[model samples]
Target chain A: MSENHINISTNQPFNYCLHLADNSLIMGHRLSEWTGHGPMLEQDIAISNIALDLIGQSRNFYQYAAQLKGEGTTEDSLAYLREANEFKNILLVELPNGDWAKTILKLFFFSTYQYYLYQKLINSSDKQLSAIAEKSLKEVTYHLRWSSEWVIRLGDGTEESNKRIKNALDELWAYTGEMFLPSTYETEYAENNIGVDVSSIKIDWDKKVNEIFEEATLPSPNGEGLGVRSFGKEGNHTQHLQAILKDMQYLQRAYPGCEW
Target chain B: MILEKNISLKKIWQILEQITDPEIPVISIIDLGIVRDVHVDENNVEVFITPTYSGCPAMDMISMNIRMALLQNGFTNVKITQQLSPAWTTDWMTEEGKEKLKVYGIAPPVGKSIDQKYLEELKVECPQCHSKNTKLLSQFGSTACKALYQCQDCKEPFDYFKCH
Candidate 1:
């Protein structure tokens, strides 16, 4: 081994990557549901590509997580073997893709938050965390732009489109809070300068989201009355995640030693 | 002896960069920023790389290319390590690489930078006439990372590398 090599250990940075990767993987799984159901062929391809991108991000993170654990576990083993309660992804990612409108709205909100989160992570003190954030930021930027454009078009287009988009926003608003809550590992990483403070992202997220909403002439979903508590950071997920995990882990679970 | 090793390693690096991405022939794997680190230990040479996308079928080709490139460069003992931490992103593309894409007649990704939210919107400049008067013909283009666009002024269709 080279002198510059560092041992993989159970540290805040490792957990941070795990959390980030898990969020993308779960959300990607949800988005994959819209593969053939998108409103148009072009839209279908776009959403599916996004789903693939997120899954790619998740695979990268999981690979790193396995390295950190220094176990013989591979990415598939970590993703498939983990229990539903063990997943640390935010609730926003696990929500069902209700309709095209709902899916875009979900993407809009989540991508907005991810933009800021990854931006901060790029400057993390931990070299590994910073490197991942730096690389992922490029892909996430496109996701944000793609989703935001859809939100504006759908919200301001036909009356039916407007109504559908608005309803989607209303339904998905309750789950947004979980994105900003700092997990225990996040707190530790922040203190150690290896992770970002999730709360700091709120201002940027609100500003950008508000700008898009205004441009689209859509009313901001009144989250005040929703009163949804954050649960994702603490591994408390919605019922939706259970079903998602069941489907996602099916092949891996059924053929425990299978390799493709 | 140490200086001789460093010189040999540098030669190997140059040979490895000649391997182009199987999918995008215009850009080499090193220019794509997927090649992470290279190390030479005694008689063994190891290259660290990350995949362009997870489950990307092209990775198998990339691994094979590395081995072949090293063997051609006189390094018989070669190993490739795949690192997944810090997922691969387009931001890693070198400025020179972006220019190469433009010269190849494919529009390079345009934007301030990529983040999780709100990527910079780039109007597809005509790859032929360099005009901003372009309209998106379709979101799905030749591949997953491209969008089909037509330049109104030049009346030519081209692919825009969607910022991803």
Candidate 2:
């Protein structure tokens, strides 16, 4: 926020919530692309199931944000009507799912951050946010555990598997900086008890990532660009998000208020 | 208990108990613990329900069924509202529902939502042979609420209702 503590506007709150919802929405869309294509049948079910969970979380946030927005704007409108440049999700989520290893590793990093964030969120003074967090934290625990176990197995299991996971870690490590960086209204929302403390979650995220990487016998990538950060909160995204928006928002845009 | 209400609360409850969860058909919504509160304010009946999981797709169907069931039972103005606070937990599952799940070849959920540290250690008895030797095949299964496990003794694969 620099030296200026900007006044929190009313729309900023829902926009922040939109940020959370967009992250899950895009990540869910990316994960769903793996439907029937997982390396194994059980993993097929697992991955898609995870996609469903993420989408579900997005729905809850979108619904809340819609209510906060008032007027005829709805969760569907928010999800389907938004442009690529309008989305406030972190760039990491908007990135393409390159490979099975890359997908799992990315999910691992995101889930780890979410686990810690939601843990703090459950205690938030905002009762509605707390309730949503309380419900979401349970599912996220499984997501963290599920993805962590896979990361460990791939990183520690065999030479080929370990090599693949190692490559994945190197590729995805840069984007993690975005998760800790607070979005536009995040600082004020946290101060007012209406949002999460993302900065505080970094310590726990580091600890968990280190613990998991150690158990997996894999090296942790040096974060922070020498820890250089990226911005998706500012609507800056990788080239991949536009394509996702094209596909995801297509049905809604083309049909125009059509429902199945 | 009456505030100028024509229908009895007990009657509304019994009628609601007849509505089954769309996915897990063996258990009714009442046994599933989704029905949180049922208030009869004159002719209007407001039913508070909670989702079993964050994204249980059956919630809409469950709501519709509740409305139809009440309407058929002579209660016309029925309202089905969702309550997410105090999130739904497996602890709310009735004893009868657990037994029904076991008999239907799905191991009932074990452990508490708060005591997640014990999740990996929670022993699941095979619903098929009641054997304690069971291995988790996948943390997720056919539905969002279950996990796939294989029984060593019975050599049969079964669904274990995962502790939420």
Candidate 1 iRMSD in angstroms: 3.5
Give the 10-residue window scoring lowest on summed lDDT in candidate 2 chain B. B1-10
Which residue pairs does candidate 2 place in steric collision?
Answer: A224-A227, A224-A228, A225-A228
Q: Of the true contacts between chains A and B, what fraction does model 2 have?
A: 0.70
Tens-digit lDDT track of model 2 for A163-207 = 999888887887888888886578778887778879888888998
lDDT score at residue A35, model 1, on the 0-100 scale: 82
CAPRI classification of candidate 1: acceptable
lDDT of 1 by residue, A1-260 (tens): 32113333445466677788899999888888988887887788778877877887788788877877675867887788887777888888888888788889999998898889989987888776676676666667768878989999998999999999989877877777767777777878888888889888887988898899988899865444225555776677779889998998998789987787
- List of chain B TM-scores, one per candidate: 0.87, 0.94
Model 2 ranges off by over 4 Å: A1-8, A223-230, B1-6
Local distance difference test scores for all models: 0.79, 0.85
Which whole-number lDDT from 0 to 100 does residue A4 have in model 2?
Answer: 20
User: Candidate 1 chain A: worst 10 consecutive residues by lDDT?
Assistant: A1-10
- Model 2 residue A110 lDDT? 89
